[model samples]
Target: AQSVTQPDIHITVSEGASLELRCNYSYGATPYLFWYVQSPGQGLQLLLKYFSGDTLVQGIKGFEAEFKRSQSSFNLRKPSVHWSDAAEYFCAVGARDILTGGGNKLTFGTGTQLKVEL
Candidate 1:
């Protein structure tokens, strides 16, 4: 079964500090990975994604992530986090359906709460 796990339930960082959110996944083969951010009472916004290509991928808002096959991990990072960046971050893993020939579903982790201190 494919699954995603986010170990951190909450994190606090001073504004302008670097942040890293850990994500782990389990899948039979190479899986599509994604990172999303959600503000309070708002829909999720895609941060980044990895299907196949460079291991390190850049995302919006100065965010980036690295996919590690050996470790089954895709961790999200931000060089400098702003107060507005404080929100819920979710990591997801996707698998393509053999019949559909496209990724139709994704398994998301619980999520990590990010708090920024002034």
Candidate 2:
């Protein structure tokens, strides 16, 4: 079975400070990875993805991540985080050969809640 694990249940960061979130996965083959951010009472927005190719991928809102196969990790990083970035972040793994209505399904982590202080 494929699964994703986010070590941090919650994180607090001051406005304009750097941030990093940890993610780990378990899969038989190379798995598709993604990070998403969800604000209060809102749908999730894609942060980044690592399907293949480059080990390092850049995302919107000054966010980026590096895929390390050996470590089974894909960690998200941002040099300066805004108060708007304070939300629930999720790490997800795309199911391979497992499609739901022709599109890949996402299994998300428990989530990491971020609290920002002004």
Candidate 3:
């Protein structure tokens, strides 16, 4: 089974400052990593993903994530955060569908709420 952990429950950052959200994963085999953001009413939006190739992958909204196999972590980062960037961020690990051998399954972390101050 694969799982993900987001240590911080809430984080506050001033506008224009850099931000990093921690995400640690647990899996037996090589894992696919992803970061998704959910606003108050909207569904989750994919921030970034790392399945293979580069360890660092860029996503929408100026967000990027680096997959560290040694550390068993895939942390999300943004160079400069905007007020609109404040939301609930979820870290997820993708798993293969073993039973049917089709599709993919994702296990997400609890989430971290980001609060931005003007």
Candidate 4:
């Protein structure tokens, strides 16, 4: 079974500061990793994803993530945080399978609430 764990339940950072959201996942093999963000009263939006190749992947909104195979971790990072970036971030993992139509099923983490201060 594949599962994701977000160690930090909540994180507070001042505007213009750097941010890093930790994520760890357990899977039988190299699984598809993703980082999503959900603002208050909004739907979940994908921030970044790691399928294959390129350990460091660039994503939207000046965000990036590195896939660490040894650590089973895919941590999201932002060099400069903004007030509008405050949201709940979720880490998800899914297996890719031809039988299951590319393994659409995704198991998400508990999520980390990000709060930005001015």
Better of 3 and 4 by lDDT: 4
For candidate 3, the per-residue lDDT at 48 reads 88
Better of 1 and 2 by TM-score: 1
**For residues 11-65, could you state the per-residue lDDT of candidate 1 as single tens digits?**
9999999999999999998899999999999999999999998999999999999
Point out where model 4 deviates above 4 Å: none
lDDT-superior candidate, 2 or 3: 3
Model 1 residue pairs with clashes: none
Which tens-of-lDDT digit does each residue in 47-98 have in candidate 3?
8888889999999999999999999989999999999998999999988678
Choose 2 or 4, whichever is better by TM-score. Answer: 4
Clashing pairs in 3: none
The C-alpha stretches of model 2 lying farther than 4 A from their native spots are 98-102
Instruction: After superposing candidate 3 on the true structure, give the runs of residues whose Cα lies further than 4 Å from its correct spot.
Output: 98-102
Clashes of 2: 0
Q: What is the C-alpha lDDT of each candidate?
A: 0.96, 0.91, 0.93, 0.95
**Candidate 1 C-alpha RMSD relative to the actual structure:** 0.8
lDDT of 2 by residue, 1-118 (tens): 7789999999999989999999999888888999999999999999998989999999998999999999999999999889889999999988665544333778888999988888
Deviation from native of the Cα of residue 80 in model 4, angstroms: 0.4
Worst 10 residues of 2 by lDDT: 95-104
